[model samples]
Target: MELIIAAGIIGLALGAIGAVIALRTAKSGTIREADNKVKSAHAEAEQVVSEARRTAETLKKEALLEAKEEIIKNRQAAEADDKQRKIEIHNLENRVMQREESLDRRNDALDKREHQLSSQQGNLDRRSRELEDLYQRQTAELERISDLTREDAHKELLDTVRSEVTHEAAAIIRESEQQVRAESQKTAQEIISLAIQRCASDHTAEITVTSVHIPSDDLKGRIIGREGRNIRTFEQVSGVNLVIDDTPETVVLSSFDPVRRETARVALENLIADGRIHPARIEEMYQKAASLVEQRVQEAGEQAAFDCGIHELHPELVKTLGALRYRTSFGQNVLRHSIEVAELCAIMAEELKVDARLAKRAGLLHDLGKAIDHEIEGPHAVIGADLARRHGERPVIVHAIEAHHGDIEPNTVLDVLVQAADAISASRPGARRESAENYIKRLEKLEKIANGHEGVERTYAMQAGREVHVMVQPDKISDAASTVLAHDIARQIEEEMEYPGQVRVVVIRESRATDIAK
Candidate 1:
């Protein structure tokens, strides 16, 4: 038993020893493996460091090459810039030198011109002194040749010139007068003829008494009424005179106021036609007649304005203008005459290149005073001007109205036109009538006035005393004096006599050269 226990202990001891040996060998093998791994890691670290150094060297080389190339480019650019500045400076220097040369040449030319001018000036001054000496010698020689001194000769020459100039001036004056007269006469005749030809108007003589025809003489009694009550009422209401005359069915209504006369005529006619004759009936009929006449006046005025191409006449002016319808100047109807004058003025104005419308307006209103001349106390022209001025007429128009009749001097072309038109209208053939006695007296007076002038051989009135021909003795009245004689005669006639239109005085100086060839 002891021996078996000893063997088991010995085996256990051997197994313990083997286990320790095996653990020591395993630890040594692990240490060898770790050492090999350490060597491999060290080798890899060395390769990475070497590669990093090579990459840094390559980058440094590339950067240095780029920097050197940039510096070379900058140096070349600076050289090019320096070369361009040098070329510009050279061009500027050449231009400056050329300009200096040009300035020097101009200065030399100016100096030369100045020297030439100075030389010419000295020559001119010497020549001027020589001319002065020559002129003085010539004046002395002339004065010595003539016995008279310079002052006396000059006075004699001036007197001779004055005498000759007087004759020449007279001739010139005569010639100018002839030329102006001829031209003005021709132009006036043409315009007057044209205006007359273009306008055709009818004028009838109007009397202050308007004759109203009744059915019978029996009705005249009724018109006169009981104790002339009807006639009195008519005259009072219509402001017209009722004349009951034995004129065979005609009752005369007389009034200087054409409107009143017209109203009375209408009323009388109505009373006769209606067979109603009484105070009350007369008043009513007069009222009706007045209204009718007023309407007619308005219508006539409107028509006249329309004919004249005027539309803006004041209402009162239009009415006043219409009243001219019943008025008369000479034997011509005043309204028709006014219308004719307006047309004539317009035509003449158009020919003369004046304001035709304004002329027409003035012409139409020129005779406006004639319509109320009985009521007003002045020249019709002045009254008409006042009327026009009151009605907001322009100052120029008012002036023209006032000057149409020569009551005032004409101040404008319009005034002259109205005057011409009025004269033309009044003096046209058949425009007016004069009593035979008065006509003969006027013609005789015209002839007498011409005969009364000195050197008058005979005188003849022609064209209804509108023209006078005076025969002058050739020995008494010279050729130039004949013109003066004619003017004098015309002036005398104008002052001594009143005539329509215009009068032309012609002086005939005939020199008889009688020779007998026997």
Candidate 2:
């Protein structure tokens, strides 16, 4: 029985062991199932995460493609905008070019129209001239038809016409004068007034230096100098005539050369002033005075150039110009006259709208011949012209100088203006002096001279000696004959009288025969 109990205990132990193993196996199976579920859950979570990541990637790719499409659209819009802008710019340029071409065409048309108008105006002016000539002829014919003396009819017609025309002419003149008065008066009156007022200096007389007066008779004795040695030396050296006459306190120094005369004057003045009037003193003073006079002459020439606004004169030319101070023409101081003429020329040039400086220069040189005429033996204008040409004066100015005295035909308008201005200056009132007796005698002589002409019926010297008006018979004096008569009168005047300036002779060839047709 004890063996059977041990066997049951063993069997029970075995059975317990089997049961423990079975429980352990069951716990192991539970653990394994829990691990599989956990693995499945992790796998599912991983799959969901991978799916979300793929979806996000797809959405981002779509957004990027849309952005790329938008960029392409903007780029296309920009290209289109550029193309349109180019087209607009090209159209604007074409429009501007078309407008410019139109303007050019319009300007060309205006110029053509203006030219046509000018041509038409010129034709109208020519027609007006012809009409005026026809009217004048018709009036003359009407006068001839009247049954009265031609002169009476002409006079009556003239009186009636003058009454009507005078008022019209006066109105026209007033209108025209209103427009041009300031300018015309400025030119004429202002210049004339300036010339008159400025040149109002009393005419001065110039004389040949024939005499040099001394302070006392004692000076004469001293100038004669210790048995006539000083006087002889002075006469020999200076080539002047010295007369220690009985006239109290005076000696005479005479020389043909004004330069020599001036030299002698200075020498004598020095000798007298120094109270050393001997032959030796005379020689010393003569030398010094000669030097001084030369210096003064050169200075005078330079001064003249300076005063006249002229420069660059050759030194030799200046010396010659200065020599004019000692010269005179027709009792007028030549240098003074030159200065006056220069001023007058400037005024005239300004008035007439000419070159003032050139005019003045020509005027200054106009009478330059007078300075050397004694030596040159030619007309003053010709000599002056030659001298000016030699001294490198402009050809025009030289021509003007030669033509001033009518030595040559005036080639330029300026030359004629100069001649006229010269005449005016010399012929102005109080410019030249003559006694009343001489004036009357001159008139009578002129009348006689004109009457001596073949056709001259009467003669009158008007505007002083400037104009000589002569009445000639129309039968004897043709237009050509009148010119010849004028020339002859001028020649006679030149031959008979010692006139200061030019004289004009005008021959009037007119016939007055009154016949009453009635």
Q: What are the Cα lDDT values of the candidates?
A: 0.85, 0.78
Top TM-score hit: 1
What does candidate 2 score in Cα RMSD to the true structure?
Answer: 21.4
Q: Mark the regions of model 1 whose C-alpha exceeds 4 Å error after superposition.
A: 1-174, 473-475, 478-480, 509-518
**Residue 292 CA error for candidate 2 (Å)?**
1.3
* Model 2, total clashes: 0
Per-residue CA lDDT of model 1 for 27-105, tens digit only, reads 6757566555545545654564455556667777888999999999999999999999999999999999999999999
Residue 221 displacement (Å), model 1: 2.4
lDDT of 2 by residue, 344-425 (tens): 7887787778998998888878887877887878798999889989889999999999999889999886797678667766
Candidate 2 Cα outliers beyond 4 Å, as residue runs = 1-194, 198-203, 433-441, 450-518
Give per-residue lDDT, candidate 2, residue 75: 100
